[model samples]
Target: MPTCSAHAVVDLDVTGATISKHLYGHFAEHLGRCIYGGFWVGEDSSIPNEGGIRLDVVEALRALDVPNLRWPGGCFADAYHWRDGIGPKQDRPVMVNSLWGDVEENNHFGTHEFMALCELLGADPYINGNVGSGTVQEMSEWVEYLTRDGDSPMVRLRKANGRDAPWKVPFWGIGNEAWGCGGHMRAETYADLACRYATFLHNHDGNTLYRIAAGASDDDLTWTEALMKAVSCLGCTSRPRGLFQAISFHYYTFAGDGISKSPAIGFTDEQYYRTMVKAADIDRVIAAHSAVMDAYDPLRQVGLVCDEWGTWWEVEPGTNPRFLYQQNTLRDALVASLHFDIFHKHAARLRMANIAQTVNVLQAMILTDDEDRLVLTPTYHVFEMNKGHQDAVSVPVHLVEAAPAVTVGDQELDPLSVSASTKDGRALVSLSNLALDTDTTVRLDLRGRAITATRARILTADKPQSHNTPTAPDAVAPADFAVTTRPGAHGSTELTAVLPPHSFAIVELDLA
Candidate 1:
């Protein structure tokens, strides 16, 4: 393949929406070792933990400035009972995690433990309430147990469990996937259930809840329409803030084949292109959902939350099939970059998003072994590098000369993706080149700003499939990239960088 050339113009003056820091949120569920070994290593373990919450994992995630963490689920949330996980550890009941590997859940990591983890990471707690097999009273009491203070049955129970102060929980979920693992209900049925649940999810002690109704899978716009229609008929003239604050949907990138997914590593070039195509299609999916929402909510009062997303590939050969653990490679990093680009563009309607799982699961940021060893994946570096864009005002990036497209069968994949944002007198521009063999030189006509200084960083490896293991954790880490700044036409600062194949880069400009 030949080298490609791409040109883009960044409008520094035309800032659109604030890219929510919650968009960089993460999900942690009870599946696999994600809870047991990934985050909870037992308070008695010698692996150096802070009250059974692994210190190393907490310290690693703290660097990303994690905004919010969704807990106890994907499908696991529907089956989980908050009451079972609270109080003394040894006294807690143990149940079979029937959804994920037939392993027993000791209920050691309960409500108090999750809130403790959030406090350590300085992130807001996004608790997913049980809706499938749980009653409304159970879900209502769980919220009160966590947030209500003064005098109440739940508050008394919370104090009895060793907590006197109320915790501030801003985000809550009505259910998981109500259409499938979350109880296989129809769209309209789930909509009614969501309204009923949200009614009793009262705010307590000045703590407001941003309730998110479990939304569609992939392209199931009917689910979104059902929720929107339900909210429209609820007698709310303006926003749907009272009934539900947001609607959440899940999207996972794969090779697009119906049956098997491409391996996380050792994938062919064709498979890589196909994955990129699938990743890029999220833009259209978000647009379609937003349009459906616009019909009922033109003012964009209700937020769109892509609560569960990221690549889902086949598990490692020796790992349990239900564990959902997979290696993260350069391709995974590129996929993340592509999603962030699309997310930044949709920041107005898109309020928050959480990657599928944070550790030892599908497209995780950190991978852990059986012992005390841990390795940061390439996807972690992307989050760290792009952390500057959190809550920053997104600026417009117009492509003048687009990157060459790679054709994989009937699908065409653009090798380049870009997004820009400005915050605190500085501007950040992120770029990703998806081509497996070609280098792309990207030119940026930085309009409406004078650059005092420029800094650049790039994350790439020799191959798209290259990944980091415990022995070589920095195999696909980011490093200082080379970017040239020169005078451009019409008083704009011109910047250029040659991005390698399967590479992701960010340019930070100190604007005048």
Candidate 2:
């Protein structure tokens, strides 16, 4: 392979647009430990739980300031019947989670439990409706059960289920992965189903529910264009409004053959670079999709929600592969930061995004063992570092100098992912050196705008192949950064730090 040379300015000032609150959203599915041991511990378990929702997991998520959480599945959403999860736990039939494992989904943790958990975390609930095996009335009644205070059949059932009033869940997904998991419908077919479902979703609070339509995979431009035209004809512009408030998109970073069930922890530079290459495409995917949306609606009002994203590999050997479990390493952490930088690159139109699974499933922010829970993956640390960009406006900056290129297999990747944000006269820039083989010297040209170095954090491991275990949790912990200031030409204040191979870093600066 030939060496690639590049120097491009990342002017964050390109658009002074604020990001939507949905950008900080996350997803949780009915896969493996994500539910049973991850976030929900039944009343019989020794784990301390509030109505079966694990207290430790909820506490860990609160620290990250988690904005929203989508329940119940990626594929599970289509099969789940909300009513079965309500009423009486004993009377509710035990159903098989065919989408995940052949395990029984004992209806112990129901709708009320989830709402109670979401309330405690202060994170809004985004429920993906079952369009594949459900009805408009069922979806409508779910909205009523959660959002309506009136005396309806669902509300009556909710009261009987031990809840006095409705639980307001503002964000509702019309469907999930219509092209694959959710019945694999054509765009036109899914669009029609979305129109019907969205029509029945009652926005009780008057706040328009963020009704997200299922979108395309990777570069399926046709899928997105078809949906946009469908929405246009479906009629949100007729003043009475349209069924869709947002159009959803899904993407994942998988190494090797891209088929799931890849190994965890012990990976080569080839696998690491391939993962980064996949992650780096998030921005391009959003941009290209947004352009298609613009052709139909110039205002760019339709939101592009990246609902399912993260690193996917096979589960640990003895563990269930369908569970989608893999260890979080410094490599995964950098991938998280890289995607955040990409999202900020298009903050204007790319309103909401969510990582695949929040705990113990796929790309989880936190993992669990028995009653004890830990922030397992590098993705968790990246969220801690980039929390500032959660709901902040994108203040673009022009990135200068030639960045080293990393290549593996047949793909090439940029070593650094850069994004900037300005608020209250302070310009904060986050740059992640995503190279897994070596550290690159990152020179930030702030133009003499000196600010107090507000401490830096680095997440690394003793070995590149290290994985977190029950006995050793701190194998990859953050350390006091080597923050050295450098004097540069033309009002430029440069700072240098070592971003470990397959690691992540963040620098905070104030404007002069």
- State the lDDT of candidate 2 residue by residue for 164-196, as single tens digits: 866767788887888998987888898788888
Local lDDT at 90 for model 1: 88
Model 2 deviation from native, Cα RMSD in Å? 3.1
Model 1 agreement with the true structure over 311-364: per-residue lDDT tens digits: 989998999999998999999999999999999999999999999789999989
Lowest summed lDDT window (length 10), candidate 2:
1-10
Clashes of 1: 0
**Candidate achieving the largest lDDT:** 1
Q: lDDT (0-100) at residue 319 of candidate 2?
A: 83
Candidates' C-alpha lDDT: 0.93, 0.75
